[model samples]
Target: MKQIIKIIGNPKIFVYTLIWLMVLVVLGTLAQRDIGLYASQQKYFSANITWLGNIIPAPGGRITMVVILVNLTFMVLFKHNLWKIKKIGVLIMHIGGLLLLIGGGLTAIFSSEGNMVIEEGAQSNYVDDYHNMELAVINTSNEALDEYTVFDQPILGKGNILSHENLNFNIEIMSYLKNCEPLKRTAPAGIQYRGMLKNFMLSELKPEKENSRNRPGITYRITNSGSSIDGIYGIFFGQSVSQTAVINNQNYEFIIRKKRTYLPFAIELLDFKKVLHAGTGIAKSYSSEVNLIENGIPRRVLIEMNEPLRHKGYTFFQASFIEGLEGETTVLAAVKNYGRLFPYISSIIMSIGLLLHLLSSLPKLLRKIPGVSPS
Candidate 1:
């Protein structure tokens, strides 16, 4: 046991381990699942934890495990004499590689992403739209209370109960779909009316037009008193509560669907400016001027595709453009994570490792020169 520890603890062995670690990380990244091809690095980790039976399934576990195993195996089996100055540079290279691995791991565990869409003249304090599905409750009576909020992840969909005491409700999400247009079902007409019906209520039949039916929300029933309310509606966007229940003389609203990923502040699209490369008409740069309202204060900001504006824990980027009466207007975003900094840090470390490894071999080449003294 001590011999194994001594081998790994050795500086020479450590450097070789880092070399293999770099190779493994590269291989792992390339060997990820097909879904990972277009997804960000953060998506890899979430996918890993989503599968059943294994901690990480086929490709994710295979790649990560191989990396760790190869790194350890190299440290144990290899013997490198790094006591000389030539070896010091090599050691620096390994240290940089270690930082890269650590940075990538941190990024995988802690990063999240979603989009924010804002229209002209519209002021919103919360995220206006999202691709993810969630369940939230709002008690208009108690404005101060958060009521109940539930997010449906892979694990949560597998039958985990979410409860809130303030509003006295328990929820279980049966299924959810986002960024999709689904085949809507029709409500039965045979049953007698049990509650108040409003004229502005949505049609019982699914709308025929798909273009106008862009956002698709979740449909989950509720356990009301004795008989279950099996057919409840949760419209697209946020707060899709179509039913009102009276509990202790107060009306409580139950929402089970998707909510728009929102920011603390409001972003209004003012105008968009586009510059194209001359002659060829290739795009050079595009930017948006936006009006941000936060805490009753409005500030004008500029956001470009790559050059996003970050304010109050949100990042605003120019996602899309609309040709309106004001020439053109762009979609200014409010992103949760400003820039993906962890991967950049990892890139820097990897670069340092490469530079040091190159420097370490220089002395050996110099010593090989004819008539050169050992000193």
Candidate 2:
């Protein structure tokens, strides 16, 4: 036990760990060129273990940083004489570093990132996750309101069956494709798909390197009382497929779309303006004018590229714009981070610590010079 502690508390081990972290950063940056940003981050930074070309083992960014944090903690508490007056600056610096590590860990675990798309003159209270998807079974019997049962992406796969107590029918996943294209239905069809899919066939395509660009398609069968009612219904995002199945005498609509997170307030888009540079297609600036409605109260606000709106622990930044047939749509990137202020706070603390250390060491540094003398 003491041997392990001694090794961990060694200053050389901490330096070695930092060197390894630098190597990981360089490798991860180069990996983005081949696998893209999202895939590179997942493989090299967020994961616990990573492989080089599916064979060589490497310690991931998360594990390396965690080990560095532990090493810093051990050095600060057990190895360094932190109580000495001369070590005050060192102590403060270590404390700041510890806070930064804690903040990073919190951000990694508790942060939420999503996007909201609001068309001109339309109001939206929900944000969609960029990469994650869900299967939505909506009860649209009542024209006034629609109740939705959403199943997240975890349990979606071939041969998987999902059921709920309130639902009298079972959903059997027949096929799932990460990327697919709709083609005109031709001859040599094995089983006919219902509704919009009847006229078109879903052809599986290779997934894009950028995962956000990939559109998913799912084919599911609805069975009730040991009988198939909806025969191989297919759904995909960005498709205008309107099909309903009657289960327990209730009409239900099914679709596969991006996962949504409903916010406490709604945002109504009033205007979206984009300015382009002279004689160039590059956009100079883009802004969105919107009204935030909450609890029957509405407040008009403008969001721009660098300027973001922070409300109720969430920050909204104007990301991009999309043109549609009806009108232009504004895309806002929403981020909810619990440790948003940690980096700023830790930076201040570290700066103060560094200043103090420099001040304390000035006399020693001056004594080493022949022409310079300390007062």
Of the candidates shown, which would achieve the greatest TM-score relative to the real structure?
2
lDDT of 1 at 371: 81
Question: Candidate 2, TM-score vs. the true structure?
Answer: 0.90
Task: Write down the lDDT of every candidate, Cα atoms only.
Answer: 0.52, 0.86
Deviation from native of the Cα of residue 202 in model 1, angstroms: 15
Misplaced by over 4 Å in model 2 are 1-3, 184-188, 191-201, 224-226, 278-282
Writing each residue's lDDT as its tens digit, candidate 1 over 16-101 gives 54564455455446635432432323333334322323253333433443355446444434535544555665554555555555
* C-alpha root-mean-square deviation, each candidate: 7.1, 2.5
lDDT of 2 by residue, 182-209 (tens): 8887864555466656677778998777
Q: How do all models score by TM-score?
A: 0.63, 0.90
Q: What residue pairs clash in candidate 1, if any at all?
A: 127-261, 127-262
Best by lDDT: 2
lDDT of 1: 0.52
Q: Summing lDDT over every window of 10 consecutive residues in candidate 1, give the lowest-scoring window.
A: 192-201
